[model samples]
Target: MISGRICIGLCFIALAMQVSSAMAEVFTYPALRSSQASDPEQSLLTSTQPMAVIYGSADIGAFVPVIEAFQQDNPFIGVEYHQLQTLEMYDITQSQRANGEPAADLIISSSMDLQMKLANDGYATSYQSSETDALPHWARWRNEAFAVTQEPAVIAYNREFFRENELEPPRTREDFIRLLVNHDELLSEKVTTYDIERSGVGFLFLARDERFFPGIWDFVRILGQAKVKLYSNTSPMLEKIASGQVVLGYNLLGSYAETFTQRNPNLGVILPDDFIVVYSRIAIIPRGARNPDLGGRFLDFMLSIKGQSVLQNEGNFNPVRADVPPSTFSSLIFDRYGERVRSFPVGPGLLVYLDQAKRQRFLRRWQDALLNRR
Candidate 1:
C-alpha cells in the first residue's frame, strides 16, 4: 500500500500539473484582433492610434514603461497620464465623472479596494483582454479591472546595517518581536514601516494581515514595543532603508524593493515563509472614456511581454504571464527566509464596506496599539 506521504506527494504533483496546464491555456500574447487580417505586418500597420488619458497614483512606477512603449507603437495616439494620491485620485475621478467631463481612458492604482469601487459604481468599462485566461482569477475583476502587476508587501533591510548589527531578518511575528527586544540598541531608531492611520494602502495591508493571520493584533503590539518609525507613504520607508537611515521596514511593496535594490545593491528583500500578502496593482478603463478604443489598445499593451518586462525591470514587479522568465531578482519570491507568498483577492464587496468611518476606526485601534500605548 502507498504511504500517506506518498499519496500527499502525488496529490501535490497532480495539482501543480493542473495549474500549469491552466496557465498554458490562458490568453495568447500581443492580443491582436482575430477578425483582423492574418498578415502580421498588415495588422501592425492597420492598428488604431491610442488616444488615452490615464489617471493613476504617483506611486505606480511600473506603468512608466508601459506608457512609453504604447506611445512608441501607436505614434498617432496621445496618451496623457495624471498622477494623483490614492484618495485624491478617487475624488478627482469621481468629480470628473460627476461634472460630465470626458472620463479618463484608464485607471491604474495600488488601491485595490478603490479600483473595485470604480468597477462597482458602474464607472469602469468592461472589455476582457485575450490574455485574461493566463491571469489568476483573483487578478481579474468581472472583466472590469485587470491586474497588471503582482506585488507583495514584504520586509526590506539594508544589508550593511543588518551585518553591522549582527541581525538576521525576522522570519515570523514572534521572531520579529524577539529581535526588537534583544537588539533594541542595534535597531534603535533604524526601523520603519507604514502608518496605517494615514495611508489607504497601509490600512488595507493591515486589514489583510488581520484577516489572514490569527493574532495579528498581538503581532502589532510587538511592533509597538519596538518603537519602529512609521511613515505616511511607502516611498519614504524604502528611501530610509536604502539610505541606511533605517535597517529594516515592513509593508515595503515588492515593486519598490526591486526598484530600490537595483540602485542600492546592498538592500535585501525577504518575503516571510509562513504568510506574505501579495497584492496586484490593477488597471481599468472608465465608462464613457474619452478614447475608449485607445484605452483598449493600451490595456493590450500592458499585458504584452514588452510592457510586463518594463514593470519587471524598472518597477520591480512580477510579470503576470507564466511563460515570462524570472529575472535575477526574482529569486526573492522563492527564498527560504519567509513564508510562501499568497495572493490576496480584493473582492468587490470589500470596497463597499471600506468607507472613511470604518477606515478611521481601524486606524485608531492600530495607532493606539502601535503608537499611543507604546
Candidate 2:
C-alpha cells in the first residue's frame, strides 16, 4: 500500500510539471513582467481577473484616464495594458503569433511603418464600426489598422534660455538649419534629437522628413557639424531641455511636448511654419488575439467622440476624429502654421522603407550623414 501511494504521488508531480510548462508557454510571463509591469503607475492590471490585454508604446500615465473612462462604460470588460518599446511591441506580436500562442488582443504603436507592415502581412484581424467608419480617409486602412491619435513632430526648446540669450526660436526648417550653422558655439552639444536606429518613431519622422524635404541630408550633415546629442526617447530630451542641460530638441513628439510644456513653463514648442509632419498612433487587433471581440469594442470606444475627449482633455493627446471639436492642438497648430501639415497617410506607402534591404540601406545613409562621413 505504501509503494502504491508513492507511485500515485509521483504521477501527480509529473502532471503538475506538465501543467506548469503549458501555463508558461501560454502566458509568456517575461513579456508581461516587462519593466513597465513592475511600475504600478505604468500598468492597469491590478486585478487578477481575466481582462483584454493591450500591448502599446504609449506610457501608462496617459492611458489611465482613458482606460478608467472606458471601464465606466464597459463595466464587464477589464483592461490589462503593457507598455513596451515600439519595436518590441511589433516583434512580440509577430513572434507570439508565429509560435501559435495567443498575443495581446490590441496592439498600439507610433511606428506607422511597422503597424502597416503587420496589417499587410495579414497579422491584423478585420474590425469596423460606426466609429471606424467616421475616421478620415487618411487615418484608417482596410478595416485593419486604425489611427487613434494625431500627433505632430515639433521642435522643443528652453524658453528661459532663448529669452535670456535673446535668441529667437526657429520657426522653419531653413531657420533651424541657419541657427545651427551660425550659433555652433552656443548650440554645440546643446541640441538633442532622437537616434533613429534605436527609436522607431524617430525613424518614421526622419523618413518622412527626407520625403518632404529634398535637402534633408544636408541638414543632417549640419546636425553632425553642430555635434548634436542623440537619445532613444523623447522624454529624456524634453527633460534635458527643461532642466537647461539641452537647449533644444528636434522632431519631438508634439503630444509629449505639450504635456511637458504644461508642467515646465520654461519649455517652448514650435510647429514648423515651412511644413509640419504629423503622425497618428495606429491600433490593430492581432490575428491571434484571445478576445478579438473585446479588442474591437475597445477599438471602437477609442475612435468614439467620448474617448477622443478623454484623450484630448485628460491624456493631453490629440484626438484623431475631426468631428470632436473644439479642435485639439493638431488643428490649432495647423491653423496657426498655415496648410503645411503633412500628415502621414495610413496606406501601403508606409511599408516601403520597412523592407529589410531598404531599411538597412536607409540606416546606412543616415549613419553616414549623421557622422559627417559623406
Candidate 3:
C-alpha cells in the first residue's frame, strides 16, 4: 500500500514539472509581469545577437556623441547607421516597407512634416515613454513619434560684416526686407540661403511661411532680387557663414547657429519679432521593425532628461522637456541678440501634405518666387 501511494505522488510531480516548462517556453519573465509582453529591455539584453539599423542625416554632428553614449550602455546590441539626405531617407524607408522586407528600426530626421506623415500612415508603432509626461504637448505625437530636439529657425549674421557696414540687425519682417533691398552692397555678394527645390526641410520652411505669412511669395521675390546665393543644404550655408564667405542666412536653425557661434564669435543669430518658427527633429520606430522592444527603449532614452542633456551639450539644441531648468539654457544668448523663441502648434493633417503632388507644387511655386520665373 505504501509503495503504490508513493508511485502516484511521483507521477503527479512529474506532470507539474512538464506544465511549468511549457509555460516558460510561451512567456518570458518580463512579459509575464506585464499585462502585455511589450517591456522588452531585459529580454533584449538576454536574447541572442540583437541588431538595429538607423536611417538619419550625417549633418547632425551632435547625434554622434549621444549615440556613442547609448552604445556604451547597450553593448549587446549592434546598431548600424545609414546616412542619407532627408528626401532620400524618406523614399528608402517607404520603398523598403512596400517591398515587405523588415523595415528600419528607427527614423530620425529634421523634416517634421515627413515624420508626421509616416506616423499618420500607420507606418510607425505607438509607444509611450516614461519621460514623455514632461514634454510639451506639441512635442509628443499620439505616442507614435517624439520630438527629440527643438530648434528655432532664426537669422544668422556675420558680426564682422555688420560692423563693417555699420548696420543693425533686422527686428521685424518689414525691417528684414528693407535690409535686403536697401543694403544690397553689404549683402549682395555674401548672402547665402536655402535652395528650396533641392531640400525637404527648406521646402517645409517655405510651406510654413505660406501658411503663416501673408504675401510670402513677395518676400521670396525680395530675396531673389537681393541676388542671394542658394545652397543645397543647411550645413553648407552654415559653413559659408562661419567662414565669412556669407554675411547672413535667413531661416537658419538655432542649433546650427549656436554651434557655429561657439566656434566663431563673429557669427550671430537673431530671432525675428514678427514670430519665430521652432522646428523639432523627431524619431519614430517603424511598425514592422524586427526589434520593436529595443526601438521602444531607445525612444524612452531619447525623451529622458539625460538624453535631452546630451543633446543640449553635444548638439546645441533646446530640450523638448518643459521641466528642464532655466539655468540649462542660460548659456544660450537668444535674448541678448533680441530674438524671441516660440513654438508652433502642429496642425491637423499636416503629415499628409507630403504627398508627391503637394511636394511638386510647392517646389514649383518656390522656384517661381525665388528664381524670378517672370
Candidate 4:
C-alpha cells in the first residue's frame, strides 16, 4: 500500500524440488474494482480475475515484455504487481504471512540478503526442474530463492565531464579513494550514492564492502566529510549523474547504469578492477500464495531460454542463463575485470548481515561514517 510503482513478475513453487505433475491451477480472482482495496497505493490493475501477485523492487517498465509474454501464454492468469522498496517488500510480506494472511505469489528483489532471510525463515516454497537445476551453483539456493540476473556494483560518472575536465574515473577502489582525497574541494557535494537508510540493496553493498575491505570506514568517513549526496533509489541517482548534477555515483547496479550510459553519451560505467562485487536479482515463490501452481509455471518460464532472451534483448536486463550472450555492458565488464568478478553467492551466508542486532549495529556505524561525520 506504499507509494510505489507496480511490476508483475511472479513464480510458484512446491514443497519438494520435484515438479508437480498436476497442471497449473487457476485461482478464482474474480475482477474486483480498484475501489475495493482500501489502500490507494495498492493499485489492483484488474481485480477479481485470477492473478499471480508479484512484489518486487524492479522498474515497472523493465518487466512489461516478460509479463506480457507470460500472459499471452496463460491468458486466464492476470498479473498484479506492487513495486515496493526491497525493505518494504520484506517487512510487509513477512508481516502479512506472520498474520496468516495471503501475500504475494512471487517476490523478486536485488536485496538478496532480505530474500535469503525470507527463505531461511520458511516464508517461501521450493520447486526443482531441469530448468532450475541448470542454474550455476551461485545462482540457486535451498531450492527456494533463485538469482535471475547477473549484474555488478559499479561506479558511473559523467563521461563529458571526465573528457572536458580530463578526469580519469577510478578503475579500482584505491583509485577512487585517491580521487576523493585529492579532489575533495572540487568534487564536494558533487558525488552521490545510495542513502543506505532508505535502500536495502545499498546497505547490502556497503555491508559486504565492510566485510571485504578493512579500511572502508576511512573512505566512508571521507564521503561524509566531503558532503556527498545521498539518494534512495537507482533511477534518480543514475539520472542525476547522466544530467551532470553529480560527477560520480558509487555502488550502482551496472546493468541499469549501462543502459543509461548507452543512451547518454555523457555517462560512463566502470567495474572496479581491484575486485568486483558481482550480484544478481533474485526471485522466490512465497508460501501460502493464492495461485502457487501458476506461479511455478511462470518461474520456470522466467528461467527458460525464451524468457531469458526477452530479458537480454527487450527488457535490457542481464539474464542469468549461461547461454545468453553477454550484453555490451557485461561484455565490457568481463573485458575489464576478467577473473576478478567475485560473485555474491546465493546462500545462508547472506543471512549473517540480516541478523537484527547485527544489522542495527552495522547501520549505526554506517550512519556515523556517512551522515554524521564532520
Runs off by more than 4 Å, candidate 4: 1-49, 334-336, 371-374
Q: What lDDT does the true structure give each of the candidates? A: 0.69, 0.80, 0.67, 0.76
Candidate 2: segments with Cα more than 4 A from true spot: 1-48
Overlapping backbone residue pairs in candidate 3 total 0
Candidate 3: Cα lDDT at 166: 93
Write down the lDDT that model 1 would get: 0.69
Per-residue CA lDDT of model 4 for 78-154, tens digit only, reads 67666666766777666667677786788888888889988988988987887788788888988899988777889
TM-scores for all predictions:
0.79, 0.85, 0.79, 0.83
Count clashing residue pairs per candidate: 6, 0, 0, 14
Shift of residue 354 alpha carbon in model 1, Å: 0.8
Q: For residues 1-374, could you state the per-residue lDDT of candidate 2 as single tens digits?
A: 01111111111111121122111111111112222358776568654434777777886656667777776787656676666677767777766776788978899898999999999999999888999999998889999989999888999999999999899999888888999888888988899899998899999898889988998998888898888889988888999999999998889998888888878998999888888888889999999898888798888888999998888877667887878874557567656764788888898988886888988988998888888932
What lDDT tens digits, residue by residue, belong to model 3 across residues 1-374?
01111111111111121122111001001111112236677656555456556667635355655565565666555555555566666665676577776767888877778778778778888777567667778777788877887777778887887888799878666787888878766676677777877666676666777777887888788787777788767777877876788888887777777777777788888766777777778788987887788777666667778777777777777777866543334334334432544454443455655778887887787777777823
Report how far residue 163 has shifted in candidate 4, in Å: 2.2
Provide the lowest-lDDT 10-residue window in model 1. Answer: 5-14
Worst 10 residues of 2 by lDDT: 1-10
Ranking of models by lDDT: 2, 4, 1, 3
CA lDDT, candidate 3, residue 371: 75
C-alpha lDDT (0 to 100) for residue 152 of candidate 4? 81
- The candidate with the higher lDDT, 3 or 4, is 4
Instruction: Give the per-residue lDDT of model 1 (tens digit) for 304-350.
Output: 77777777776677777766676666656744423566665746756
